[model samples]
Target: MAENKTLKVPGATLYYQVRGSGPVLLMIPGGPTDAAIFAGVVPHLTDRYTVVAYDPRGNSRSVLDGPAEDVHADVHGDDAHRLLAELGDEPAYVFGSSGGAVIGLNLAARYPGQVRTLVAHEPPCGRILPDAEEYLAGTEEVYQAYRTGGVEAGMKRFEEFVGLSGEEQEQPQTPPSPEMMEGWGRIGGNLDFFLGHVLRPVSGHLPDVAALRQGPARIVVGVGDASTDRQYAYRSAVALAEALGRPPAVFPGDHGGFVARAEEFAVTLDKVLNAT
Candidate 1:
């Protein structure tokens, strides 16, 4: 069974869960979503490494001390540090997807000693993109669609970008809803945090990645098989791997493939984590 608990950070009450045993593994969930979004993959690995998944402040079970407008990456990163403290401050392996991958990369860059290995899957780092201008423009368009219309419209635009129609993209179930966002009024304060603190600073974020490349710390980039042609994530993964000078390892599914192919993905993930 999974054990749920809370950690009090600078301005947030972070809700996290622990399961399994062995080396610690921290899962950084994607943006606009919570840890529950990883339901399929989490359970499969608990029997090996202890898996810790938590919702960031202003999201699902977590709570914030200040108004949502005060949310920022410093607060979020500090919250992550606090959570690590509760785990005895021992360095742990981290697996992050999308926005969460961005966060983990930030953490690894900012505090290299905190992470043992980082498996960053498809971080949307505009700086690393060959055509960053066009990429940001597309991202802004999606954000506008979400803001002007709603999740449906935003998803529709996203589907179109990835060559999926509404009907084709629609699964039997819905992906987890985003708990906070830039346009939601709740996520307004974090925009500067995400862009300035995380983005602009990312240029020098992790010098240790090079050292890590030579040491026990390994940086693995992951892409999805199903997302090869139409997904920005796959392209991003390829770009990141190129930047890192390493070939990316293909994961089992598309963006959300980890959830649907949890068992197979989890096994592969375990092997990758241990190998690193």
Candidate 2:
């Protein structure tokens, strides 16, 4: 069983899960995903690492103090910094998926000492891309779609934009286990908040190249082996790595690979973490 805990910080109360026992490895989820997104992989990792996963502020059990507003990467990063601070003084190994990757980068830039190694998986930091404006405008359109027709419309636009739609998306997907399904149930209500407040900010936010490069923490930009270069997030990952003067690390599967290919993803992560 995972130990569930809460930490009050500023306008929100963060809900996080602690599993296994070793050096801390914090997994940060993106969009509507919560601490549970890593459920499939955490068990595989527990033997070697103390796995910590948290629901981002305003998502799932991490409750906002009031009605949600447009949130930024820095705010989400601060929430992570506080969680790490509460966890221990030692810098933690971090893996951030999708939007979580963006937040992780921000945290590393702002407080480099708090993160030892950060594997940022497809951050969607379009601002660093040559065609950044187009992606930014697309995210804005996604937000507007939500405002116009609610979650259904928004997600349809989002999935298509990020290359998560149609027949291909169905293939190579690991069916969610009962635990993951239960986790999704808890996160279902988070979509509106995710679409409105989280998506655009993360998609448009720029990574601090200088801070990350100069920071003591080692940075690894990761992408899925199955992802096409035409995919915005895939390209973003490559671009971020180039800006950092390093090639992107290839993971096992596509964007939601942590879910679909949990076992493989965990093995790859273990190797990456042990490498440096």
Candidate 3:
């Protein structure tokens, strides 16, 4: 059973859930989605880790204290640091996806003392790419697409940005479970906040690689096996891995692997976290 809780942060009230019992493993979900996104993976990890999943301030149940505004990766990073401090006395393991991964890197760079290991899965850190200017422009386009259109139109543009329809190494996809479908619908509903305010600032972050390399937290950059090199996220993740001087640990599916292939992703995640 997961215990629901909330915490008062600098500018928002964050909603979080805690389950299992052992070492702390904080799960930070990407933008547009909240802690509910981890429902499938949580069941598998409870035996070894106390899983803490949350809605990053403004998404889902985490209500913003003021009107909607642009939130930088470091702001979200600070939120993670506060969450960690409130949850446990010791440094905790962290797993962040997409925008959340960007936040993880910021957290590790600025507050490594609060994190033991940070598994950053497919962070859209375009600044590290060789053709970063081009990539950043495309990222801006993605934000603008959402600004002009909506999630439906924006997602189509995002899919194109990630080459989901263009040149992807299309792996056959199993129909997402009903739970996942429901989760997707909810995410779709809240995506305005993500595409509207969260996307640009988070994606635009230029990671402090020197700080991360020198920091105590072990940084594990992750990419999805189902994603190809041509994709924006795949390319950026690879670039980030190179910047970090470590090969990306491959996950099971594409960007949504943790949700689509939860059991396998969980097993792989456990292995990666335990490996020397």
lDDT of 3 by residue, 17-63 (tens): 99999999999998789888888888889999999999898887899
- Superposed on all Cα atoms, model 3 deviates from the true structure by an RMSD in Å of 2.2
Ranking by lDDT: 2, 3, 1
RMSD of 2: 1.4
Which candidate wins on TM-score? 2
Give lDDT: candidate 1, residue 56: 70
What's the CA error at residue 173 for candidate 3, in Å? 9.2
Q: Flag clash pairs in model 3.
A: none
Give Cα-based local distance difference scores for all models: 0.66, 0.89, 0.86
With a 3 Å backbone cut-off (N, CA, C), the pairs that clash in candidate 1 are 20-46, 32-178
Give the per-residue lDDT of model 1 (tens digit) for 91-139. Answer: 8988988767766766666566778888888765655667666666665
RMSD list, candidates in order: 5.6, 1.4, 2.2
Please give the TM-score that candidate 2 achieves against the real structure: 0.96
The positional error of residue 53 in candidate 2, measured at the CA in angstroms, is: 0.3
Better of 1 and 3 by TM-score: 3
Each candidate's TM vs. the true structure?
0.79, 0.96, 0.93
